[model samples]
Target: MNSLSAANTHFTFDLFQQFKTSKKDDNIFCSPLSISSALAMTYLGAKENTAFEMEMVGALHFNEVTENTEGRTTRDHVEKLGNVHHQFQKLLTELKKPTDANELNIANKLYGEKNYQFLQTSFLYYVESVDFKNAPEESRKKINSWVESQTHEKIKDLLPKNSLEFTTVLVLVNAIYFKGQWDNKFDKRNTVEKEFWLNKDTSKPVQMMKQVNVFKFTSLEDIKAKILEIPYKGKDLSMVLLLPDDVDGLQKLEDQLTAEKLREWTSSQNMHDNYVDLYLPRFKVEETYDLKDTLRALGMVDVFNPQRANLSGMTGTKDLLVSKVIHKSFVEVTEEGTEAASSTAVVVNVGSPPTHPFHCDHPFLFFIRHNKTNSILFLGRVSSP
Candidate 1:
């Protein structure tokens, strides 16, 4: 019998827990299986395999237009979705080997490979930025543009189109670029605003951004958390933010997380009216990760066990070990709601705006939530966003 190490289990447990809590807080549901798949690919020595998941997802969102009304029947489109799901499952099922030699060899092959079009062809576009380790601005901008185009311009509108659509997006665009500002920025001109608390005793005249619109919101004493859902312009996408009342409540929520808890929290939320005296900073970031080694470091080894595992359905032979896992995700938050997009397919574009000032100032967990299911498509945090 084979098993994950204590440290590895702890890592897995922590990642799952964090994902659950954060997803719950954000009112978004991401497929745990997908995360597991990504993690497992890493464990099987398929360092690039994890990135494949991120980039593919990002690409899906990048080009995710309202399901087109073209001649393709919804049934046919569903079949395509089913085929993708089946292929993904096949990849996961094949990488379950338990031998060290098999696992290590697969890892070497995955890391050594250059042409990862298999992943791209599977609907994943990849991208990355090579910081001069000096982190030159020109290099950084070049890298940013590459990521933007790889995601099919569903991202960074500021980049030069030519310079932006480089191969880097094919590898790193879904890695995670986040930018946010408060829904209610503090104006130097009008610094005098009154603030109010739900409890009158705690009330101070605060600068509340007067807003008018419906929002998905909820308060849970059982969980000690407040959840808010902000929809994107397309309405297909949204940002769900969860704020734990106790500054330390996040850890507790993480520990108490479960599928049931998640379902409960999301279902309990309702549309409501809200007000806020919000002050938040505008912050920008870009993070690229090579999850190949990380997943290998985890405990998934079958899919990448090229020799032992079987994936004949994909490539006709057992030689196809997942070569790389690249992820790039980007988000921009402002007073006009939230806009974000991720790419995991060969190419795609995906995003939004807001009213009032929904300042996500406090320690809050957010998610890039899709409307269809309770599954968190993407999970994140705004410890400072």
Candidate 2:
């Protein structure tokens, strides 16, 4: 579990770096857990070097369960790989466990051409397959409907029109929906329009929700930042906010940010109970991304290239490769609580802080995490209201 958390931290920073570069000066949001889970299912069909590459890029940590018999080293490696997938399955199952107070759903599905020779027995555990050949548009709509249902209609049209062609062989998808009321709810009457600094020279009016309470908080002098953790009703999940001291200090903080650094900043020892006059903006963010180029940039190239790809594990042949990876996410934060949903589709053809007056009057980074597993469910930068 510790290793898995570490891997998630690393992957989160890696994806954040990419997003920072691509969407400069704009707000960004994503579900690293959703993407990783969906790709874990896709990874089931990867073999040899392809498998190794995917494992490394995905940052999936699997404990090695080795048999000591002679010539069993190779067998052990194979077993370890299988164990990795099993762990993902276990984690996904755990995440989907029912919680009445909080509505959380994580689901996976594989849409394939009707005649595609998919290994139903081996792959069934990871993803449920649906035929996409007979009616491509209908199949597309069906997948979208499933995403909608899974996300409580918070996410729609996940796979945009004309994005899926008739030639698509496989499409792997993972959708996650989360809605939790704050352990200490804020009064709606306290929300008021306030100035949100976009930068030194720009500002905008935002509906700022205010509350005064004792929260887990910390201030890092070295980083010029403050950290705060607000628990949701279940206590198993929380939002950790990181805010820079200076309104223009976000870029500097970003320059020094790392998975290890984040771990240290959010460490239990660093957080102490403190009275905080919290002011957060009421905002909604809906983001979509085409990750082919980004994944390739991260050295996940073979999976997207038909000529060099190796996915024989799925169909016992190299006839398929990922054509695109589409991801869509929605988030709304208000006085009551937070509601967020994200969907990641692997198209086949192929493929802070707080506190201390923790007034978030400027851009900042935040994460919705599952406390038990230490898995980051959603990550975003609120550059604007």
Candidate 3:
């Protein structure tokens, strides 16, 4: 369980980097946890395929299991990622449970063709039966409808036209929705038109929300950036923002960020409470991604390649291969709160304002963190907003 957060964190950053490399100047957003959850369902079903399992685990950021305690490093140890089935289940429950303080919903399901014959999963997994062979169109609509309802219709047309052909046998879908109200909610009247720098030479006007409150803040002397934590109503979750000191310094900060380095930078000890002047722009980003290329680039090739793919663990046989992984996520940041794809808790008090100045008037990185587990649910960069 302890390593589960690490896994999610690692994968989150890994996927972020992949997106960063290509969509350098664009607004970026995705829920690595949601994608990991969907992929893990298939990983759990992989049986007797040590190589493929190792690839899946490694690409997913799964750490060393019990078998690798000493100096041992083999495919099997990676494959037998100690009690992973239990950990996956626990991760889902931990993310979705104790929801009163937070509005969070995570829905994961596996749909298989009814007429296709395959082995059952090891962990009493539930694979929803659908007539993909006979009614691919209806199955597609049905799957989309289920996901739409699961996410309160925030996500629609998840499976677009012709995505599910008659030959399609299996599909995995994961949807997450989160609503967070700032503990120290910003005043709407304070929001004013401000300049947001996209780059050294480019800038745009934005509705910047200003709030003077005591917030968790810290300065990175080496990187010349600041980190601030804005808790939602319950404080179980927070929006952790990283702002570069220079208008064009965002790229440098992002380059320096890694899973381990971020832990050190944002550790509880590093951040101190002080009166902060926070200026965040009101923005919303809804992105849909086909992650087959990204996953393959991260060393997960076999799962999508039908000829050499192996997911015997998911079923009793090796007849299943993922056809497509479509991820659509939405996040909106306003003065009142946030409606994003993520969750968490914390206690914050309203008090005096003004000492520290942490302005987000330029491209910045923000993460919605589950403070209890310190797991990041949704991470994105607002390059233009």
Candidate 4:
């Protein structure tokens, strides 16, 4: 699971760079965990060139493999498939364990056309038969409703009215909802309006929440930045904020951000428990992304190409190809804690905090990490908030 978490972490950095470059100066947020889970669901049915392409898609899917999944496959192909689904199942199972401190719900479900013969193997998500051919609209509603319910209604209308086509074969959906109270909660009375700098000269008034506490802190002397971790109740998860010493240093920080750098900077050995002044703005960010273009730009071209896709493991034929992937995420940080949920649906588609006088007055990077598993459930940027 740690390897999978690391792989997902690597993917998160790669994806952050893509969004950062494309949506320059705008707030960016997405769940690599959700996206990876959905893709892994789709990968269960991929074979031959498609399987090979996905497996080596720059650490896209793990090598655990899934043998004996539904549908008929050559002995060699089955051997190639292994236990990737089991890995995801394990991940889902582990993350789904009940926790009293946070309202966390994560679910993955595969909705497929009623007639396709699904390849049976380890089930990482609930597999449902839908009438995409006869009732695409109703099917879309059903999927959206399920996603909404899974995320405590935080994520709604995940699949728009026209999202599903009658010809759509398989759609994988992953939704993660988390509401955690800060361990050292801030007092609402301390929140006040303050200037939030979008840039050195440009700024806007924001409701800034202030607090003083001891936290895992580190100073990036080389990059002129500081990192702080504010744990949520139960201490199993923490929100980490990386603030640049210079008011306008986010770009340089982002340009230098990588999995290795993040690991080194946030490692326990580098961070120390220290008392510091902390100020974070009360903010909420919701963004939707049509990841088809992004994924293709990242060299995942063949899966979207019907002519090139070889997902024979699905129905034992090279007929299925991913059409579009849509992801919608919402997050709100207030005095109590944070409320965040993200839904990633494959049309086949398919955090942080501060301390240390660590005032997030300017654009910065943040992520919500599940401390025990070291899995980053969410990664985002607060450009304006």
Candidate 5:
């Protein structure tokens, strides 16, 4: 779980950098967990170089203890990879365990061409085989339906029209839905329109929710930032908010950000209970991304290239390669709490807080994480609202 959390932090930052380059002025939101889970399923079918590339870029840690074999055999490596998937399965099970305090769901599925040769024995624990040959559109609808169901209908049309074709071989997907009420709920009656500083001169009106409460908070004088943890109802999950002292200091914070830095900032020792006067805006963010280029930038090249790709673990032949990776995420933060959903499809076509006067009146970075596992469920930057 530590390694998985670290991997998620690393991937979140990497993906943020990619998105920042293009949509610098827009709010950024994503589910690194969803993306990693979907890819981990795909990684099960990767072999040799393909496997290595994914393990490196995806931050999947594997412990290889070979007793007597010369180095490691293909069978041995595959078995080790299976162990990793099993761990992920366990983690997912824990995440989805029934809880009345919070409504959370995480699901994964796989769709393959009916005629395609897929190894039933090698399939990951969460994969569900679906036929995509006779009617590609119908298969698309079915996959989208599953995503919609998993996300409680917050996510729809995950695989857009004409996205799936007859030539498509495999598709892997992950969907996550979370609805958690704040331990210290803000009063809707107290919410009012307030100024949100986008920059030094630019500002916009936002529906700011006000609250005064004791929360886990910290001040990072070194980075000129303040951090706060807003726990959900179950206390097993939290939204950690990082706000810079200066209105336009987000870029500086980003410049100094890293997985270790995040871990250090979010460490329990650095946080303590403090009374806070919080002003957070009610906002919603919906984002979609095509991650082929981003994955390539992160050195996951072979999986997207048919010529050099090696996903023989799935078909026992080198005829399968990922066609595209599409991700869609939605989040709604209000006075009561938060409702967020996200879906990630590896279309292998083949292939908050804080008060402390911790008023988040300006742009800030935030992450939703499971407290026990430290696994990041979602990450985003609230630049506008």
Candidate 6:
């Protein structure tokens, strides 16, 4: 497969710029890997921008994961991710975008006939010319098991619930395992039962993490926002918090969010010396979503348009179409810090932040990012401190 090249660098950057600008906050991060994936998929006849944008929006579902998942294992999370990807792909395939007569017919046939049905199952399938039918049954089963285990079995069956004859095929499988502890470990003694501010005049009883420390943070008047950087145990990951000055000023921060502005704000974060008392709730969130509709809304109309897509690289016949896209994420928050895992993919990756003594004490938007690439792996908001 061809790699993402410099030829489309500006176009790709522009796409991301538009994506960041459209968001109410700088919540989207794309990794080079994601970019390459989309580019290669597109080169094979997939809609590149649609795939990339869908991945970005797919990240949003993780917010719910951070709240629902308590002690789920990494294996469980991986399967969940696969199922989510399948659904998202389904949505992409079904979207009604502008297309020519032939591509349109192909789109309907590809999705209508359930050619991509393998997506909903556990056996991850790609439309490259290769045969695994004769490759040891044990090998095929192992590949399926690994994909299931890594995605936490969120994806159950892979090779379709039914048998259908397919010609060309390609498959790549990998898994990610993550486990981490809270930074300020909530003191069982200090974990007093208190009311959390859910909205003005509305509160709910919750066990919040309490701490006193110097937190690396910044207050941006220009955007009426505050930023706090919370480091993970390994220091390989950190959460960047964005808090609106006004309790309900999330809109203001959203309006100012942009790729350039986010880059500037993060780059300019300064270490500080000050005492801060923090009270944060302990919560676990988990979420799963089918990303077909979201991708359609992001201007990726062609990939799903079977009649228009030219994935001749994957299938000599213009009969293959992306059928679904699904994503799932998990996160747990407590006094010590947060542990989060997102499965699915994006084109931007956030590199690790510079380590400085900091504590999360208030409401903020935090993003998990890879340190080297400065790409955002995940982005979330804690509404209460």
**Which prediction has more favorable lDDT, 1 or 4?**
4
lDDT of 4 by residue, 282-341 (tens): 989888888888877766788888899877767677877776677777788977888523
User: What does candidate 5's lDDT look like per residue over 1-90, in tens digits?
Assistant: 445556566777777777777778789988888887788888888898898888754433333212112323324666667765765776
List the global CA lDDT of all models.
Answer: 0.39, 0.77, 0.79, 0.79, 0.78, 0.42
RMSD of 2: 8.3
lDDT of 2 by residue, 1-385 (tens): 4454566567778888889988877899999878766776677788766776676555333222232223243245566566656666666777777775577788777777768667755675554445555566777888899889988899999998777777777777767777877877777777899999999999999999888778899999998999899998778889999999999998888889987888888888898898788889998998888877877777677887778788888888987787667778888887768752322221112112333689999999999988888888899999987
C-alpha RMSD values across all candidates: 14.8, 8.3, 4.2, 7.9, 8.5, 15.5
Cα lDDT tens digits for candidate 6, 344-379: 221212443343322233344556544434545445
TM-score comparison, 4 vs 6, better candidate: 4
Consecutive 10-residue window with the lowest summed lDDT within model 6:
101-110
What's the C-alpha lDDT at position 322 in model 1? Answer: 49
TM-score of 6: 0.56
How do the predictions measure up, each by TM-score?
0.48, 0.89, 0.89, 0.89, 0.88, 0.56
Pick out the ten consecutive residues of candidate 4 with the lowest summed lDDT: 343-352
* lDDT of each residue in 254-335, candidate 3, tens digit only: 9999999889988878988878878899999988888989988787777787787777765556677887788888888987
User: How much is the lDDT of residue 72 in candidate 2?
Assistant: 46
